[model samples]
Target: MQRRRFKETSSLEERLDQEAMRLREHKLLPPGWLREQAFRKARQMNIAAHINEWLASPGLRAPI
Candidate 1:
């Protein structure tokens, strides 16, 4: 096996810019309603987790 190393360390801003460029090179991302749906799904999952946690604690039970 061989080891590899970066020519030099990169700053946080430079790393983020590089990531954005790489993503753009990959065709295009979902847009409009599709993008909205993706975000909504993520939010729904987060809310579900919070609700489940609350339900698990009798003192924090949500009103039926």
Candidate 2:
């Protein structure tokens, strides 16, 4: 088996800036506060989905 080496990646801020520029170019960028709110909402939804999946999996059981 060959081991894969990971390369260094850009920082989170850099990635976010790049995304923002893309959005701006496409005229889809939202206001700063709205963008922040949307990010928070997206994170919450992702966490909720993960928790729901864990609850539904067969390996775990609920206590009576």
Candidate 3:
């Protein structure tokens, strides 16, 4: 038995399918999962507005 290799151009559908297949083969964790849960817990404590304000203030400062 011999292995065969072929090179062929991919159609748009084929490219999309290949991309999906590659992603499926990878182990991807949800982004900031721990931070997301922490945020939810903090919101239950009615601190979400403070958190948003804290996050916004520094970024809002004008450049010197």
Candidate 4:
């Protein structure tokens, strides 16, 4: 087996922003499983992004 990797042309913020917008579009649907699926993914993505941001915040370090 072989592993493949490629460069990401967009920044993390840019990618997340685009994905968020895409998920929001799902809300236009009346009601269905697809909308729920998108909602869950969006929620997970939002939470993960926030958690990562908090973990990387400078306040997490011991005070000097």
- By lDDT, the best candidate is 4
Candidate models: Cα lDDT each: 0.56, 0.59, 0.53, 0.81
Candidate 4 off by > 4 Å: 1-9, 62-64
What clash pairs does model 4 have? none
Each prediction's TM-score versus the true structure? 0.44, 0.48, 0.29, 0.67
lDDT (tens digit, per residue) of candidate 1 on 9-54: 8744455455544544433445666556555555555566556566
lDDT of 4 by residue, 1-64 (tens): 9889899998665677678778978999879999999988887777777877788789898887
lDDT of 3: 0.53
Clash pairs (backbone) in predicted model 3:
none
Candidate 2: residue pairs that collide: none
lDDT of 2 by residue, 1-64 (tens): 9999987597444455555444345334455776666666555555665666677778897766
Models, CA RMSD each: 12.6, 10.1, 17.1, 2.8
Error of 1 at 8 (Å): 44
For candidate 1, the clash count comes to 0
The better candidate by lDDT, 1 or 4, is: 4
lDDT of 4: 0.81
